[model samples]
Target: MGLKLSGNKGQQSHRLVIFAAIIVLMTLLILYGSNNVNDAVYAPFHVATNYAIKATDLKKWSGKDGYVPFHGNKTMNLQCHNCALVTSSSHVLGTRAGKEIDSTECVIRMNDAPTLGYETDVGNKTSLRVIAHSSVFRVVRRPNEYLQRPDSNPVIIFWGPPNKIGKEAKGTLYRLIQRISMTYSNLSCFSITANKMRKFDSLFHRETGRDRQKSHSWLSTGWFTMVIAIEICDNIKVYGMVPPNHCGKSKPGSKKMPYHYYKPRGPEECVTYLQNEGGRRGNHHRFITEKQVFSRWAKQYNITFTHPNW
Candidate 1:
């Protein structure tokens, strides 16, 4: 009887060891599955951001001409007028308040002046680097006609608003857009305004309606501009940009520096949405945050992000 009992006890011990082994294997399988699921979930966001940066690469778009294609093959054109040019210019000389006699230095343009043109050569054969008035520029076009990406033509960056505030600048912006449009029939124009931006908004007063100073006062139309640029371009080069003083303060006579250009009225309300999540749901307009995300995404997708500050 004692021998039989001992034999049974040994068998029970063997079964217990097998059961524990099964549990350990199951636990390991669960851990591996959970990790794979997490990776799968994050894969798309990584891919999208990577693809966006790759879309902005010049090498992928470069042709026989020295010109670089704007935004991969996708044209995400933004229009701006008198957005303000904080460029490097010789400082005005006056012997005042210092022993240093009239030393030349960089001077800031505090007022809205003439609009600088981005000259496009005839037949879309020639290329020129765009120089402008305000560091943060604006572009205007019909609703949804924000940018144009052509196969055979040079990519053009646009800046200027449609209103009479800066007519010549507006004209210059239109000229640039038309030049690109003339060459590329299917240029994608992405209008960045809060209110309706119909074609000929700048040419005809037909598109204007309500001012955004009242409702939804925390959104920056520029956010739309950036989104379009990021989404379209394979490689993006940002130059002459002012830190996000979105009230259009960079421009002359901009009262109260309206923080949100998308709202119905200016300074009517100070909402968190104005400062964060204005254009893209996940985007905040902080300079460092934008720079970091853009850089990482660009690098991952082999796109270069260049700032003119250097």
Candidate 2:
């Protein structure tokens, strides 16, 4: 009876050990599954950032003769003491602050957002134009129109998904940028790859409690441009960027502002995108969170926000 009892006790102990091992295996599986989900959500931005970094190295290209250096082979040169970040927002319209906006030695603009007609507000001078890879074709269609004044000959920085810059190098956008760069001595273009973008994203999240994974969105061109400005300039000033929901919370009878001042027809899709992302249930680009991050950075860096408070 004693021998039988001891044998049963040993069997029970073996079963308990097996059960614990199974539990640990299940826990590890759950953790790995959660991580995969997070990675999948952030993959696009990651791929894009990485591709951009790879493309930036001109030596990686077999046909190096096709592209010329912008600032004498330097990716970015911050010779200017101060810079201005000019965003396309309706708040700046009718403000007639063109002189102030243009006064800065380095003025940065976004995409195909124009300044010719609204020069009085947005300024005609552009030292740098930050464009997405998706919009490269649009610029190519009307180079003179989009490029604006030839005197400025802004250095273009094209950013996009990794696929767009990597294996798809033969695409029109890539070819166009190369052709234009080769044709125009003053015009030079650069690619901001995924690796650099990831660094900025990490920094933004670390500084602010907001996670891009939780937000389910990538950084906007404006925010990315701001990050570049912070790195290259001693002092930075932003115009026409307001906190999220500023228009909705304004006092009664206040003029409803459009997302872009240049879009006189109606509010652009970006406005809707921002609104959706700002909603409680939404999982899109966290424009508000990015704004908050910028506000925080402003306190730490030599940055200032003008026109529609930060």
Candidate 3:
């Protein structure tokens, strides 16, 4: 027999292994202080948030000099779910009529249209308004069911898909934004169709709600872009939108951007809906990603939090 414990049974087995490791570190700090979630995580805090938003002046919301009028009546934050900048003034500018007018005349002559051209008199005064902003412009059925679109080109959903359906998005949102708009045609272009939100609420008087149930409504054909440098462009320059569920370093079988497509939804279908116990007096807490529920609703609606680094 080699004999073992003697010092009061080895100090009561080292005080019961320090009381079971302080009860497993207080149950992992009370489940990481009640279900961990502080991730603004834009790629590890985007270089200290782009140097604190380049010391806040943000180019006055540059479209270069003018053009800020795409207001489809109120409901700003452009497309909510945490809305960032260009918060409101509710984009309603116009001018872009030269022919193809039908979404009830692109919602009543979209401000008199002309910075790139098009208009058969959308109440033509001289034409050059520009500014549409997207959340999801409706209409789709094509497999030949006859609905297909991509004209009216206001940079329609950063142009993709077989070059507006000729053939090629098998993967990698086609070298991100169709090989850079086939070598840069003003960065990420626009112009999407399938209008109908009652002519986008009769071209901005506002009231077209019924898209139904929610998850990504508003007609969802798909599009997302925001380059606005920023100045006084009101409601915070829609903080140059980027958060549509980023992918970046491009992995997990690369080739993305059909609309920046993604998958991930495990862990028992990733639950949500606590709402209150979180938000803890607005210091913030409740989130299930969508860029931390739109960056805590863009800092609770003050808007302006653009941090996707480059």
Candidate 4:
């Protein structure tokens, strides 16, 4: 109130204040960007490390009052050094590839996908089965003779909504899985923890910029199974999981490709699901985007694809 500054001097002071504020803002942004870069670099390793620790604890968790029921006999260790992930696709039936698929040290199958009638195409061996809660009832209750076969005793990893496994819930599928595991020592059942699922959900969103939670959709069984394989295997070979564009499309020879080789019928829903992923009429699953993620992973990890383009 006592002294007044010249107009130019006042203007210079204001400019200096603005400059200082800009410097502070730039510093904060630089720090934030650096943090994000670190996260981007280390996130996958963090998940892998967590998975490795959890896998080691799996043996301990097989005992009484543990999440996984104990195997009546010794636990069958998964040998995934050079594993083959056999997806439930019809393309796997082509070119007498079943023999090659069976040659892998470990062969992982999806859902209740059968290999009995289609043994010549899909191979007769199943080391592990990745099952979803929705399909549990069908796999356990179906009258298929293959479901009861002793050789079909694949270690089962089941995943689903948290409510399905809650103590008070009366879900038949959950109860059936429990009953089957209790009765059959050969068929061990392990539920993927809710925390692990959420971690995977976050990782998918961070990697792909797509959030399944926002769409109220869950990760496909194939995607989850692949993650498990990556954790355990040094070499991973994928069969029958074609890129989305190849589905329901014709080849250069004018021969049309079916969505699934097992179900050669027209208008396969899987093809339609892939086609409509990001269209005006969209689907819950972002299959094409998932394929893109897999392609990137294939390049980074020891992963290869067979039967149609990856």
Using lDDT, give the best candidate's number.
2
| lDDT by residue (tens digit), candidate 2, 154-264 | 777777664565323446555666667677666667766556556556655564545666656666787767766766667888888886546446676566677778777
TM-score of 1: 0.27
Runs of candidate 2 with Cα error greater than 4 angstroms are: 1-74, 166-170, 244-248, 268-274, 279-283
lDDT by residue (tens digit), candidate 4, 7-117:
778889999999999999999999999999867643321122223211122222222222333224434356568988888776676557788878888888888787777
Ordered by TM-score, highest first, the candidates read: 2, 4, 1, 3
lDDT of 1 at 137: 38
**What CA root-mean-square deviation does each model show from the true structure?**
18.4, 12.1, 17.7, 11.8
Candidate 1 RMSD computed on C-alpha atoms after optimal superposition onto the true structure = 18.4
lDDT of 1 by residue, 70-149 (tens): 22244333322112112111111111212111111211121111112211100111111132223223423321222232
Model 3 ranges off by over 4 Å: 1-14, 26-105, 108-158, 161-310
lDDT of 3: 0.27
The whole-model lDDT of each prediction reads: 0.31, 0.67, 0.27, 0.66
Candidate 4 TM-score, C-alpha based: 0.69
**Per-prediction TM-score, please?**
0.27, 0.69, 0.23, 0.69
List the candidate 1 regions with Cα displacement exceeding 4 Å.
49-310
Q: Write the number of the candidate with greater lDDT, choosing between 1 and 4.
A: 4
lDDT of 2 at 41: 52
